[model samples]
Target: MPQQVRGVIARSKGAPVEIATVNIPDPGPGEVVVDIAACGVCHTDLTYRDGGINDEFPFLLGHEASGIVESVGEGVTSVAVGDFVVLNWRAVCGQCRACKRGRPQYCFDTHNAAQKMTLEDGTELTPALGIGAFADKTLVHAGQCTKVDPSADPAVVGLLGCGVMAGLGAAVNTGNVSRGDTVAVIGCGGVGDAAIMGARLAGAVKIIAIDRDDKKLEWAKDLGATHTINGGQVDAVEAVQELTGGFGADVVIDAVGRPETWKQAFYARDLAGTVVLVGVPTPDMTLEMPLIDFFSRGGSLKSSWYGDCLPERDFPMLVDLYQQGRLPLEKFVTERIKIDEVEAAFHRMHAGEVLRSVVVL
Candidate 1:
């Protein structure tokens, strides 16, 4: 029998999400049911509500989550029932071309639960990022369940499921930040702060954080940034250059994703330096820059998907780090609220009042 649980859903475009009864069916083959303990409020959820991701209405709008595997279906061998895990959107199908080529992080085909969770009237809902988790329970592919240290706080470690992982992966995996390198991150939201922490973990000598909000900038400093720049008050590129001895930084990450911020990252990196774009942009947005600049940049310009992370490899390590006090995961959780407060959390996120307003079940 399907279980009926309360879930937050975007029933229509640009409409506020509401708590409704979601019917989660028993797991099918290769799937597992998770009893979510905590789910973080991410900007993507807000985007889903605004019709930014797609026209897919009635989206199950949460993904950054931590939970325990309640049960497993046939052929699910990787994780068993009762395992503490973090849910990830990308469940790489090992046979995909990218996976076969040893770059599973770029897997073209990812998996979700074969079964659909529905409304009482049987309206099938699209899971946001393929792991709709803003509820008491969620169903996902076995591969989406990445086990982590159960001793860690669910509310803190759950953040590694999305925004935090993306930022860290952008700096470590994509940008290849190295020890003693000078780094700068533009935008100090959850993602940006994670990038700062990643750069610090990679042994960066100087990590400059750029953001328009002083509150966010202060938060960035606590996350390992060596310098902070208020972009709204000063020229971002110039500040980054001056801080990096006029040669610019070795790696400049754009966590804001807008074309303007991307441009700042472009001009803020030293020659032969890398630029990693971790921010998500809308389809209608376009980039316009001098063709000559692209050629003269003399380095790689890359966009990261889910921070180019292989959850199985990164999640446990991050959780362990958090447990050891090397990574301050708790700093990301600004507040904890019930499932029904997701809409209010979204508003607070938009107003830049919180790094993350997590839903604690």
Candidate 2:
């Protein structure tokens, strides 16, 4: 029988989300039903609410979530009922061209729960990142539930499901920061701060965080940034060059995803350095640069989609890192909120007041 679960839903674009009854069906083949424990409020959720991502109104918002498997559909073997798990948006299909080429992280054909979760009035709901999780229960493909250390705080560990993963992977996976390397992350928001932590985890000798806000730059320090540059106070490129002993950082990541910041990252990177763009940009945003610079940069300029992460591999490893105290994932959680507080959380996030406000179910 389908269960009526309490969830936050956006009834229309630009409308505040509301707590509504949603029907989650028993897992169909290859799917599983998760009883959500906690979900983090991310900017992506706010984007969906503001119609930044698409016209998909009535979106079931919130994707950074941790939960327990209550039921598994046939052929689901990745997890068992009762497994504590983090919900992931990318459920890679092994048969995709990317996966077939031994790059499952780039799998083109990811999937979600086979059945549509619906509103009380039977309206189909578009889930944020295909893993709507601001609810008591949600459904996802079997591959989406990555088992983790149950002892870890659900509010914190769940973050590995999205923004945190994107940030961490942007450093460890895309930028390929190594020990003794100088790394700079522009934009000290949650994603950029996570990049700072990831560089530290990867043993970066010099980690520079750049932002306009002093408060965010200070927060970046708490997250392991070795240096913070107020872009509003100084030219980011000049500060980066000076901080790196006249040479720019070995890797510079643009977490703001704007042309100006991207250009700063491009110029602030040392020759043969890597630049990873993990920050999301709007569709109207266009980047213009000298074609010669692209050729002259001499190394990789990569855009990471979902941090090039394979949920099955990355999520569990991140949870273990959090459990082992190697990654201070818990610091990302600024507050715990009720489902109805999402709008307020969005405001707090916009105001740069919190790293994350999680909803505990």
TM of each candidate vs. truth: 0.99, 0.98
Which pairs, if any, clash in model 1? none
For candidate 1, write residues 143-231 as lDDT tens digits.
Answer: 99999988889999999999999999999999999999999999999999999999999999999999999999999999999999999
Residue 208 error, candidate 2, Å: 0.4
Estimate, for each residue in 3-98, the C-alpha lDDT of model 2 and write its tens digit.
Answer: 998889988878878999999988999999999999999999999999989897889999999989999999999899989999988888889899
Model 1 weakest 10-residue run by lDDT:
280-289
Write down the RMSD of candidate 1 (Cα, Å): 0.8
Error of 1 at 338 (Å): 0.7
Model 2 spans with C-alpha error above 4 angstroms: none
